[model samples]
Target: MLANPALQAFSMFLVGTALTLGDVHSHVWARACWCLTDVLFLMAFVQWLRWPGSYGRKLESIWYLRWGGRVSLRKAAEIVYSEARAQESVWAHAAERMSLDKSPDGILCYIAEVIKQDTTIYGKRPPSTHVEKLDPLQLKYGTVTNGAREVRMRDNAKTVFTDLQVDAKELRRALHEVRESLRTTMPI
Candidate 1:
């Protein structure tokens, strides 16, 4: 029901040509062009009905690029995923997940995976982070040492705080700090 003006005009031209030629004498080419135009108009209307306005517009733009041979299927898929990830709903879900107590470890693991993938893809590391420098200490020991800690501690028993309670608030704060640091220093 939605009509693109140019398509409508072309369809009208085809119809007029057929009418002038008479129904019985109409050329097959005129009938074919009209039918094709009608089908295209219907398809466009159906697509407009199917998607929300903004999404439909974005899809239409991408569709043009795809059929125009300006982008490959793989690149189109990557563009779609990037656009989807930037959506507010997606970001909200990510924020909620990252705010959880277990998320910091998962996030760090994901970052490590991304680093690995980037290295494999580009044959080099993507960028540097504080985690890169502290990773060895964190892996060898359970924690990283601030220089102040060495001055206050005499023994391994004194260095480790077994009684420390990490509540959800503290975990969330720690995750935020880590996220901020990574955002500042890394492309992630």
Candidate 2:
């Protein structure tokens, strides 16, 4: 029960609801127990929701640093990958606790797939040495070409050209692909 928060919550909720709805209403002790159980279930649910073994937070942090000019895409990717690899055990434990259908190793392989996809996206930046240098003024204030916004050059002279809008459907498709791959790879 300690290992399975959802099950603990569900069992508590079931017993609490039964006590509240059934003939146990006349007993004050039963009502108090029910309230306690319900509160425990809520706490367990919140704890489960706040589980820190999430890749999304890591990705968001990388994106934030990149957008804020604190790190380049390549550097962000390296950090993200290193963090993901370091947290593999946490992720595996999370998978074991959260899922009964898929094995922990299967969840790890899913994480690997996401890491590969993200690496491809963030690793495609042009090498710093190959970046074409612009005028100092142009470097200070990047120009927009064909409506695409160009980000300022880093100290290493690498610039990022962004379209300012990402397709929501494409992002959803990538996430769905990761989930679908996990489902498909799991044993029946």
Whole-structure CA lDDT of model 1: 0.36
Tens-digit lDDT string for candidate 2 (1-188): 46565566566667667776786746675666667677777776676455344668655643654454333332332333334334443333443455433643334333333333332222112434333323434433442222122333354665664322222333334333433342322466
Pairs of residues at least 3 apart in sequence or in different chains that clash in candidate 1:
none
Candidate 2 RMSD to the correct structure? 13.6
Highest TM-score against the true fold, candidate? 2
Tell me how far the alpha carbon of residue 188 in candidate 1 is from the true structure, in angstroms, after superposition. Answer: 38
Clashes of 1: 0
Mark the 10 consecutive residues where model 2 has the least summed lDDT: 116-125
Q: How many residue pairs clash in model 2?
A: 0
Q: Provide the TM-score for each candidate, comma-separated.
A: 0.23, 0.29
User: How well is each residue in 6-56 modelled by candidate 1, as lDDT tens digits?
Assistant: 467566666757665776565676667666667766766765555434675
